[model samples]
Target: MSDSTDNTTFDSEDLNFDDFQLEDFKYEAPFQPAPEVQRDLSFFKSIPVTVTLEVASKEIALGDLMKAGEGTVIELDKLNGEPLDVKVNGSLMGHAEVVVVNEKYGLRLVDVLDSALTGVGH
Candidate 1:
């Protein structure tokens, strides 16, 4: 390479924000919808994501937690037959119910979270 200096360096002070607008800086999805009115979200389809079904949560005293054993029973906030919260990558995705298929425990989707709430596309 010649003795030319590189201008690729990034400096926050070098940016001009005089014409910037909050709307112009809003986030947008990387993909677009299909022509058939379907969402073409195959961009990150192959990426693995962690899914968790939250049954319930309860806050117990430290003494009670320390005294818990194999036979110990703890109460949760949710009642029996209540729907469980389905989380994707630690974000609330939807609500589901426990189901048994092929002798395997699974979750049956009950309701999907709204796109607006999940920030799925907007």
Candidate 2:
């Protein structure tokens, strides 16, 4: 029909090549610094410290371990009345002993060992 032909022509005209143009394209970008802002290095130097309590031990055979059970008490080198090793960041710093302060258990520094072993304080 002429009406159907007119409808088809109208639809084709909607998608015609004259209706499209590439001049409408756009490019946008804000100016930014090439190098990012640097943080203060001094903040890294003031890291929180922790004192490590280490019970020095030695490895034994599995057969010996099988012989150890409930009543068996594994002994250590620093026994009662001996000063225990006090470490800082996995390094042997000094020695300490168990003490009670205000009804709470704490470590009392007994001696400051020579730093030659640690290669520090020299």
Candidate 3:
């Protein structure tokens, strides 16, 4: 057999396929599932996953980063009042907004990710 992009040529007379056999095959044993394999998925349900909420990020020079003080402020790439990204296990799951819940800061979900079809959190 040859590919379309190949430039090499072969001599058909040098090939010999007359000695091939088809009836000599035999099965040694029947196929079976392993003893440790189980249909239950209880073990996967107990696993822990990390959930994270991102606010903003910025990159600055090393010299500028070294001159930081208690009153110093570094500007981020994201603007204020933008929706925050909610990630699960390092993947983007959805977006949310900051809310006040009984004097405590909380995240109110604005969108939920659907990963059933594409298998991607984003």
Candidate 4:
């Protein structure tokens, strides 16, 4: 049989922590500024992004669409000479106007999305 005596056991009433000061628990750690990180993101310029020029769109009944042929001209919601929406990776990036360059179709950027709208820098 083990002896029923143990000096390591503690009793809540016997402990007194009120005499210790708060400064006694404090540790002095060295203070230093964190090092800045340097990164090379030049490869971001080489990333490929899909750009699309949206002209106009119209929704018609399935029956009407099936009946229409190449000669059919559907009226769009946008008016003539309106700026086209420029999309990058299926996201609205800016607005542009259509132009003809060397007998090829091209778009001239009229307005670009501000940083506040795209949340670029933020």
Candidate 5:
């Protein structure tokens, strides 16, 4: 007898492909919480509120503005060395000084203006 193995009977039909049914491959989604979950509001009672500053400005005549060439001064509502007005939602809220923090420039709140009215529109 010669010492050789001739096993060539393996083919696609030999495997049981019908065992993998469509229902076995179906995916089941995980549970999710309802959209209308109630949340507690007591934590927001002590939150600090602040006002912002907004500068009221106007545009000068085009002829007057264009005449502003070299060394010509164009005046702004604010004066020199005065802290820039800080406004929130188009209303003056406070004043701040320009400061540098962590290699980046930011505003340092210096003063907060008192509201004109006690309870009504500010």
Candidate 6:
């Protein structure tokens, strides 16, 4: 058997954290501006994108389509001078007007559809 006595000593006043100072260790951060990061957008630009210019569409029956041949005139639903729908990878990206450049058909962008708000490009 041993003597059951509380002989541990502890003084709250002896423990002082106010005498600590960080000046004992010399530390100086080098005067260096952040490195300029050049973003390379060539990868995104190199990606193949399909741009479609929607002119018009017409729903015709299978029997009527078979009956039509060369010299047959089919009418579309879109009116003349109407803005054409521009689609990118099957997504509606914007609207454009048809133009002729160097005897080639070209499209002039008129309105750009917001992909973030409209969730167009997915």
lDDT of candidates 1 onward, in order: 0.85, 0.72, 0.80, 0.83, 0.70, 0.85
Query: What is the number of residue pairs that collide in model 3?
Result: 0
lDDT of 5 by residue, 33-114 (tens): 7798566755554565565544335579999988889999777777667888887556676788777899986788788777
Instruction: Give candidate 1's error at residue 58 in angstroms.
Output: 0.6
Over the stretch 1-122, how does candidate 4's per-residue lDDT look in tens digits? 88887679778998777867866687888997789766665566677989999998888899999999988988998888889999888888898998999999999999998633354322
Off by over 4 Å in 6: 1-42, 116-122
State the lDDT of candidate 2 residue by residue for 1-122, as single tens digits. Answer: 35555443457546767667757867667887688755555554466667876656657889988999899977766666777889877778898888899998788888877774444222
Model 1 Cα lDDT, one tens digit per residue, 1-122: 78988779899998887867867677878897667765766665667889999999999899989999998889899989989999988888898999999999999999998854445332
Candidate 3 lDDT for residue 90 = 86
What's the count of clashing pairs in each model shown? 0, 0, 0, 0, 7, 0
Better of 4 and 6 by TM-score: 4
List the candidates' TM-scores in order.
0.59, 0.48, 0.56, 0.63, 0.41, 0.57
- Per lDDT, what order, best first? 6, 1, 4, 3, 2, 5
Candidate 3 runs further than 4 Å off: 1-43, 114-122
How does model 3 score by TM-score? Answer: 0.56
Candidate 6 backbone collisions, by pair: none
| Alpha carbon lDDT at 35, candidate 1 | 72
Runs of candidate 5 with Cα error greater than 4 angstroms are 1-59, 68-72, 115-122
**For each candidate, C-alpha RMSD in Å?**
15.9, 11.7, 11.6, 6.5, 14.4, 8.4
Residue pairs in clash, model 3: none
Q: Which pairs of residues collide in model 5?
A: 52-86, 52-87, 52-88, 52-93, 53-86, 53-87, 54-87
Best by TM-score: 4
Model 5 lDDT-worst window of ten:
113-122
Runs in model 2 lying further than 4 Å from the true structure: 1-45, 116-122
Q: Name the 10 consecutive residues with the lowest summed lDDT in model 4.
A: 113-122
